[model samples]
Every structure is written in C-alpha cells, then in structure tokens.
Target: MEDFLVNINGTLLKGPEAKISVFDRGFLYGDSVYEATRTFNKRPFRIDQHIDRLFLSAEKISLEPTYSKEVILSEVLKTIEAAPFKDATIRIVLTRGTNSDLGLDPALSGPNNLVVFTKEIKPNPAWWITDGVSMIFFQKKIEASGSLPKTGNYQENILANREATSRGAYDSFMINTHGHVTEGTTSNAWVIKNNILFTPPLADGVLDGLTRKALLEMAKRQMLPLPLVEKSLTKDDFLSADECFITSTTRNVVPVTKIESHLIGNGKPGALTLKLLELYLEFVK
Candidate 1:
C-alpha cells in the first residue's frame, strides 16, 4: 500500500486517517472547487496560475477561503516537501464545509478545505501518445449556455466519462445543446484543420484550462501564423478535422486519431500535435 499525506482544515494526516464530516455540503451537494497540477523535475509548473484559478473557482462557487493565496501557496509547498514522490500531481480541493441541520442553505455552510498528497502522473498510455486515443461523441452535452462558472457540479462529466469508458473509448467529446463540440470529459478540445488550431469558444461552456492558456501564448510567441480559432463546431466538422487533441493538467497534449468510427487524418497523430507537445514539454522543463 502507498502512503499519503492529507491536510484537512490545517492539520496533516497520514493516509487512511483523513476525514471530513458527512454533512459537508461539498460532499453532499457537490459544492466544491478544485484544482490539479503536475510537477516537472520535482518543481510545480505554473504554481501561480493554478492557485489563481483555484481562487477564481472558489469565488465563483461562493466558497469563502479561510486562507489567503500566500498561505495556500505555502501549504502546497509543504505538501510537496513531505511527499515521497519527487515527480507528482497535486490536488487542492475546497469544499463549502458543513451545513447546519436546520437547512441545506449554502449560506450556512462552513468551510471544508483539504490538500491531498499526490504522486507521479499516470499518463494515459504509451499507445495513447504514439498511436493516439479515440473519442466518442456523447449524446450528452457539457453544460450548455448561461455560464455556471465554478459551481463544481461535475455530475454531467461523471456520467458521460463513465459512458465513454463503458463503450471502450478513451474519452468523450461533450457537445453543447447548440450541437457544438465543446470539450472532453476532463480535458479541453483543440482541432487542427488546414494547418490552423481551432477550439470551442469560451461561450460554449468549457473550463478555461491553464494548459490551454499556455498553448495560446506559445502559439503567439512562435508567430505560428496559425490562428487559434475559436468558434462553435458541429460533429461533422470534428469528423472532418485534419487532427484533433485534448489538453489538461495531466495529459499535457494527446492526439485523437479517431472519433467513433471516423478515422482522424490517416489514423495517426498529426505533425502539429507532435510539435505542440514538444514545445509544451520544453516550456515546462
């Protein structure tokens, strides 16, 4: 069994001992905001960006953080120092705390903060990178229109991702009610078409990912001449894309060689996908 260090409130606990009340609104009602980050060569990548996003998510969900950004940042460093794994992923979860039995009102909920010890990222698979993964178009749409911000209501993702796995797919591409391919179950979607990178607009209801932001910057720096196009995409458009990939904290960049039965550009990772992955890795290192 592996050991882990967990922080509940401000106290650190060994694996198997960390606990929160069952009445926590976050657990009972999914009223929580969270962030995931990976370390490169034992150093956290984009720590500031991740923390900033965490705060933004918490604010969106109305969770009052008891600690300031400086405090949380220090805590994250402490967690890394105590961890056994040199290279690891860090998960910071902030719950809306426990609600008074009087009612389920978030207004009365207390704060529930937890930091978990993490380890080496278990990237999808070698084949996922070399041969690329496949995606299934889920009939389900990621939360469409009218922004929910960061309510942490992830049930849709839970159900859709489970469906994807049950169907033997690596991930699911969640379309919106408007029929635009928005994002993946846990990653942001990007498509390469006619040598340009295209992704669903923020209006399409996808989480603005840190890696996505970085990629956009890289594209600008290289003067790639390729536009980071943002527009609604239909299933047919995705099927015909020259290449497709998803980005997130874990899978830095993973190509999608197929969508359902439609083969993605010769059924292999595209040249642009490889270049982007290399550039991203170099940026971190």
Candidate 2:
C-alpha cells in the first residue's frame, strides 16, 4: 500500500526516481538478468539462494558485476526495510551498461548496472491455494533456439501466459522443442503419481529453481514415506498424473486442479499437495 525504496548502484532512490539509460544494453539488446523473492512476515525467504542464482545467470551471460555479493545483499535488505507490506516481492537486476555504440557484443564500454527494488505483495487468493488453478499447454515456436533459461527475454512467456489466462487458465504449461514438459511460465512443475513426486530435470531446459531444491530437501526429511524424483516428462506424464503442483518463490506450492481439458485428481487439490503446502509453511516459519 506504499511506495518502496529502489537501489541503483548503491544509491537509494524512490521507486519512481531510479532510472537507467536507454542506451543500456539491458534496454538495447535484452542483455540483463534478474532474481526475485517474496517475503514472509516482512522477512525475505531464502534470498541468498536467489542471489546465488542471479550470480550464476550473470556468469552464464558473461556479466561480471562490480558489486560484491555482500554489498548487493545489504542493499536488498535496505529496500526491504523500506517496504511497508507484511509480504513483499523483491527483485534485483543486472544489466550491461550504456555504451557508445549499440551492439550485441559483451565487450561494451560502460559499467554494469544493478537495480534492486521491493513492491507490496497482495495476499495469495485462498482459492489459489485451496481449490487450485488450471493451465494450458504452449508449444515452442520451433524456429526460436529457445535454450535460454533464467534470462530476461520473457516475451514468449508473457505472450503465452497472456493467451492462457485469456483462455481461462492461470498460466501455461510450456513444452520444449523435444516434446518434453519443461515448466510453467513462471514456476517449476511437479506431479504426483502413485504417491511419488516427479519433475523435469535441468537437462530438460528448465530453470534450476530454489524452491524446488527446498522441496526436495523437505521431502528428504519426510519420514512419512514420500519420495521425490527428477526426470524428463511429457504432456502424457502430466495428463496421467494423480496430482499436479508448481513451485516458485512467490507461489510456493500451488496445486493444479486441471490441465487443459483433463481434470487432475477429481478436479480438486490433492492430499499430498496440501501436505507439501503445510510443510512449506512450516519450513518458511
């Protein structure tokens, strides 16, 4: 319900005042990477892992931030302190800075730009967690190389998600070129079959998500006979699933009540899905 602070190169500015150049490669060529996390009770959850992944993304794109990890974390904490929400979504971005010429080369002549900001997050709708959500399938364009993961080139996901929501779904279940089920537009997908949890592996061109790792760890701590496994998946795998769910920093473990025309597990949230949500609530607390 309030404006939050923004951190650009260590300077704290009002969210609206923080600005970057149009010539910045992030604007020019989509040469940027970002990480996001949501807070619980004003405390950002597993932000370190998010920052670590941000670094990994930078490395993948050959971006070397002049700021150290500690400095960036400190700036993020400052912005969180300025946010007035019980729950906030914090995002950090690194971009190739402005240069004399517009080019795709990484050897630009400007200092890399960093942006950190927090926004008030509304409470997740109870129905989203209880009754669950629906999704449609999005096939890749076939011409796009599409191997980029965790980068800022989100036009495809934006378009697919817009189309899916317009068609009465919350998001789209994306399919890679190999006909493998990859993930949701903004989440990592998982399914339960015969009481075992299954998800796509990183080799299937999915983002290595932090919440997914936490869930796997939580599963390991389960003495309740729950098993978690990662493997390649397809539309058939999801359509035949006993239960389906997705994980992200913001939407932790949201059950999938349906996928396209197929009703997942009687068109209701599954028992294991609810249990995992409880586990996640406790884990975050």
Candidate 3:
C-alpha cells in the first residue's frame, strides 16, 4: 500500500507522480475551490457536508466544476480507499484549467481540473490537548473576506501562522479592522463566559466551519443550560473569558489556556472545555 495517492480527473497515480500544469489558474492566481475531509476508523466523517461546501465555494467564486457533485464525491472516496493509512486526510481541489492566453480573464480559461488526494493524518502535539495551546493576537488583517468560499488563496493565513510561530505561540487569532476577533488562522474561535458559549457570527465574515456547525448542533440537542450565542467578539472578551477553545476539521476541539500574556481561567483546560471535548468525541464515535 502506498503512503499517499492522487487522483487527477479519473486517473489515479502515486503522490510523487501526480502533476499539474504551471499555467493552471490555481497555481498562478489561486483560482480554485477546495475541501479537506478526514477519516475516522478508516471511514470518512461528514463527507457529504464537505462536498456540499465545496460546491458552494465553487458557486461563490463563479468557477464551474468540470464534474457533478456526485462524480467528485465518488472520486474522493475512490482516492481515500486507495490510500494505505487507516486514517487519512482527503483533499478535493477544483481549479480553472490552463488558459490559452497568459491572461487573468476567466473567459480565457478552459475546463476545470479536479484533483483528489489522500495523505496520512497528522495529530496535534500531545501537549496541545493535555496542557492546552497558547495563542497570540495577530494584528495583521486578512485580505479574504470571511464570507468568501474556501479557495486556494491562503497567503494571509500562512503569514499569520508564521508570525504566531515566530512569537512562540501555537496559532494566532486574527482581529478584523473593527477590533473584532474574527477567527483563528484556520479554525473557528470560541469562548465560554459564565457558562455561555460565544463565537463570531457568520455575518462577521467568519467561515462556516463544519466542526463549529457540529458543535452547535450537539450543544442544542444536548440542551446546554445557556444558549450558544453567535455575536461579534473582541480580543478583550477572549482574554477575560472563563474558558477558550478553537475547532477545526483535523483538530476537533482544543482548549486555549493562554492568550498572549494573560492566562485563561486557571491556565489549564477548563472543565467546560474538557466536557465539551468529551461530548464531541462521543459524537464523532
């Protein structure tokens, strides 16, 4: 079994053998929509939602996919199945194909190029979950609007994460121009105050993360005492919260112990955050 696999259009190839044209808009202008789905117990988790979001992203960017959603889904499953790992990450990318002319106009583009690949899942450091991760406030602004689709453009996030790492932090929480804490570099940010869950609203331009959606659903069905409120949050709010956490596809729910110099609560994963993580794990099972 191969450690990695790539499916270009309908052809499967080893990861090192996979290739795309340099003239492809996805490489040149980041003109692409993509989705990342991870497997649990050798089976895909929330694959339908991921694929749906992929189509939604394509629609938002006005980039028509070369294949139907069903076809894309089938291709993703096929690639994952061909991978060697018991648990893996599957990435589906749809890029505007190479243009006849070296121009920025979409009209010059050809058919979309669909690429699906699978790789081994990399878990977060044990300390990240056991002791919680330290985060810093990234003052730099992200150029992409939160409402935009999950496209190939990620320069801003890359820079933010780099800055965070340089500053000796696990990740960075980006603040908008208005001083509102939008989100983490790649995850959805959340804070618990007085037992109430607070996160930036989608209206604030934050991506509608699937993990965030799942958490909200779980919270509602479990009927938590306080309702999970979606509101515009500021850095001060996060720093002063009783507990803090972030959610993503790979890292489901991780506690945030410190933000900058301030220690959140007791500086360890709070009870509520741990409880929620337990519930989330059970939900995943």
Candidate 4:
C-alpha cells in the first residue's frame, strides 16, 4: 500500500497523501469523466484509445481538463513507472474542479483537476477463463450514449449488481426502459450463436468498450470465420444462444455460461469463446 502511487494535479504523491476539495463538482455533483487503462507486461495497452474516450467523455460533460493530452500521457507514464507491480490498473479521473458555492453552474466551478492512480493488477482465476461465469438479468432502460460515457454516476449499475449478488451471480444484465438488452452492470454483452457474434449496437446505450473494439479488430484481422454483428439483442436471443460472454477493460473476455434459469450451450465455456480469448490476449501482448 505504501508503494502505491497517485498523481494529483501533476504532483506525484502517495495514495494516502492525495486529497481533493469537497466543493469539487466531481464530489458535489457527478461532474467528471474517467478512463481505466490496464497494463500488459508493465506497459499500457491501447492507451491512446482510452485517452480518446476520456477526452470524448469530458467533452460530452463540458468538463475542461487543465492538463493537455501530452501532459496526461506523460503523467500517466510517470505514475505507472512509480508503481512497484509489473502489471497494473491505471485510472485517470478529470473533474470539473472546485467551486465556492453548491450551485450547478459551470461558471461557478473552479479550474479542472486531474487525478491519476495506479495499483497492482490482480489476475482473474484460471477457472474463470476455463469454466466462465454466471449472471442474472434485470430490466431498466438507459438511453444510449454513443461514445459510452463511463462517468462517476453509475448508480444504476451498482443497484443492478447488488441484485445479481442477491441472486448469487457474479454480475447482472440491464434491460433498458425500451425493453431492449442494453448491457452488463459494468461490461458489454455478446451472444455467440451459430458461429456469429452478436452484441447491442452503440445506439442501445452500450459502452463502446476499448476491449470490445480490440476484439472486433482481432476477429477481423485473424479472419476467423465468425462474423461480428452489432444489433439489438433480447432475452429471447440469449435464451437460444450457443454461448455468451462479457467484455471489459479489466476483466477482458469473460464467458457467461448461464443467464437466469437457462443454461447456455451445455453450461460450459464454448470452444469459440476460448479461441477468441486466446487471440485477444495475444493481440494485447
């Protein structure tokens, strides 16, 4: 814990030494944008893409970052270098700065603030990659945001995940108010059937995950006969799926062998799922 590194406004400090103002809009209101970048062999993987998404999210929320892109990239590298672990999970947070009053007005807000934190990356169990995971679905419509803004205001996911926990599942799927399959509590969902990979389009309010994008590219480059389709998905589609999985920055490709009462494809990690995962890992390295 003492070796953990944190960068607050370009100042490298210990995690315990880092602090932010209470009046910061990120604290008072959910006025912030963030990106989670993971490392492979101690180097950031696809960091450019993550930075692009971070800037996009900040633009969407009108949160101006004090540090330019170059500063961000350099500072992030420095923070990563300060970490003792060979692999890490790097999180960059840009807040709307602090304010004197509690008003929602941006003009009243102070200058933007940036925080970069690094911690040792913990690998998921070997069984998780082989046996996969189980999940439950809950219905709740969220209007799709194309860039997939992963903001601090993710209370919906928190509640949905709690629902999954009560049901003894690792994660849960959220169906939007429009009665469509949106995504997982914190990941993008994919259904593999008949050798085709199907997932919700960006219009469905699904986060355009960096890992998901990379996997799609890997699928194409490898010329794996499987076709990647981005379309609206439903419970019925999953109920008949041969295999299902979720993708995220930290978790990578996680097989979803079970959903609610239905068993997916003999209730095991499908062959194709494992193959794609192998290819994905190679791509990251």
Best by lDDT: 3
lDDT of 4 by residue, 206-241 (tens): 788988898778667865558898888888898899
- Indicate the residue-level lDDT of 232 in model 2: 89
Candidate 3 versus truth, CA RMSD in Å, comes to 1.9
Indicate the worst ten consecutive residues by lDDT in candidate 3.
Answer: 139-148
- Which residue pairs in candidate 3 collide? 146-205
Task: Please provide, for model 1 over 69-158, each residue's C-alpha lDDT reduced to its tens digit, 9 standing for 90 to 100.
Answer: 888888888878777767778888777778776466877776565555566666568897889998898766444663335455778887
User: Arrange candidates by lDDT, highest first: which order?
Assistant: 3, 4, 2, 1
For each predicted model, how many residue pairs clash, with residues at least 3 apart or on different chains? 0, 0, 1, 4
Query: What is the TM-score (0 to 1) of candidate 2?
Result: 0.93
The TM-score of predicted model 1 comes to 0.92
The better candidate by lDDT, 2 or 3, is 3
Ranking 3 against 4 by lDDT, winner: 3
- Which regions of candidate 2 deviate over 4 angstroms? 142-149, 223-225
The predictions' CA RMSDs to the true structure, in order, are 2.0, 2.2, 1.9, 1.6
**Model 4, stretches more than 4 Å misplaced?**
1-3
Estimated TM-score per prediction?
Answer: 0.92, 0.93, 0.94, 0.95
Determine which window of 10 residues in candidate 4 has minimal summed lDDT: 139-148
